[model samples]
Target: MSDARPAREPGRRRLVLWRHGQTSWNVERRFQGKTDIPLDETGVAQAERAARLLAGLRPTALLASPLRRAADTAQALADITGLPVRYDRDLIERDGGAWEGLTSREIRERYPAEHAAWQPPGGETSAQVAKRVGSALERALDELAPTGQLVVASHGAALRLGMSHILGLPEETWERLGGLSNCCWSVITEMRDGGWRLAEHNAGTLPEPVLSDDRPDAGT
Candidate 1:
């Protein structure tokens, strides 16, 4: 299946923000922030499958968080794309502090208001995460070839916040961009006007066309 779009003008590029596949903690509903847990068996399979499809896009550069999960996912792409993986510490998941390794229910029970606000007692703020991740992404973009694509393997929240920052979305509207599922990706294309546009969000593969004989198609 191909999700390739039309070629862009010279110097234009695309960024593929890929979230790492599921981990053991993910299955346990635990907060995995900066935990450095390796991908579970299913996650490795998911990455391999997704890499096969993403390779069709002919990505030029591969970047990932230094954490094990993200690194392993990026390595899957590297094996297929022959692109060396570059690790960026800034791409790491949000530091959940005291919340790390704790289940959602545990966090809520321990710190109700903080959990509601989605902030840990001693953790990095959303704005701080956005800044670091956005900066790292810009650096990756600088290294990309004109008209090339960069595949970024990172965490769910990190990618969402980073993409929001890169797109210049206000903090209030950031939540409008939902989180990505494991092994899913969001694509950003450089616009002609020197800005970025979200070409795809939480995309796992090319959509299969729906066919129904009874459906009407009267308009040309």
Candidate 2:
């Protein structure tokens, strides 16, 4: 989305966080998680290319979601960046609750009550998936020095939520940012003055791309 921040012509800590590639769940439109699912063959190719592209940037450190798909995606880049990948649960996908593995239509038909209960403004009451995202993001900013380049391997929802935090977006604006695709990234740079700016968002590098035809461009 169009981050209204004036591009900090040159910024400190060029933090680049990206989501993992597609999975079988993605193909069938299901919620994935601690399932230990590997990337699909296409996802492999996408991660490979994305890794190659990011390799030269030489990130100072790499943090990733412990999930297999995300870890796999991080490996592609780590293979190049030579950065160690540390695990973090904060990067986990928002649990879909009773609808964990079901599609949107399936959720409506099967677990409508649970579906209705889980709104965007606030994730599962005590579950607090957003809190995890926020904590991890805050940790990244707090723990990781704004020195060299940085990269985080995470999921679509968390990445979007983190980006929302980066842009200082209202909770209602979540719907506007939309969903992210496999191996696509929203590159952002942390400005020196404690602010952030967007580089490019949802930039696809998938070799056998699972492209989203419906995702809109970043904007206000």
Scored by TM-score, the top model is: 1
Please list all clashing residue pairs in model 2, or write none if there are none.
Answer: 1-218, 1-219, 2-218, 2-219
**RMSD (Å) per prediction:** 10.3, 6.5
- TM per candidate: 0.88, 0.80
lDDT tens digits, residue span 70-119, model 1: 99999999999789999999999988889888886798799888877877
- The per-residue C-alpha lDDT of model 1 at residue 150 equals 95
Which residue runs does candidate 1 get wrong by more than 4 Å?
1-10, 205-220
Task: List residue ranges in candidate 2 displaced over 4 A.
Answer: 1-11, 113-127, 205-220
**Native-referenced Cα lDDT, model 1:** 0.82
Colliding pairs, model 1? none
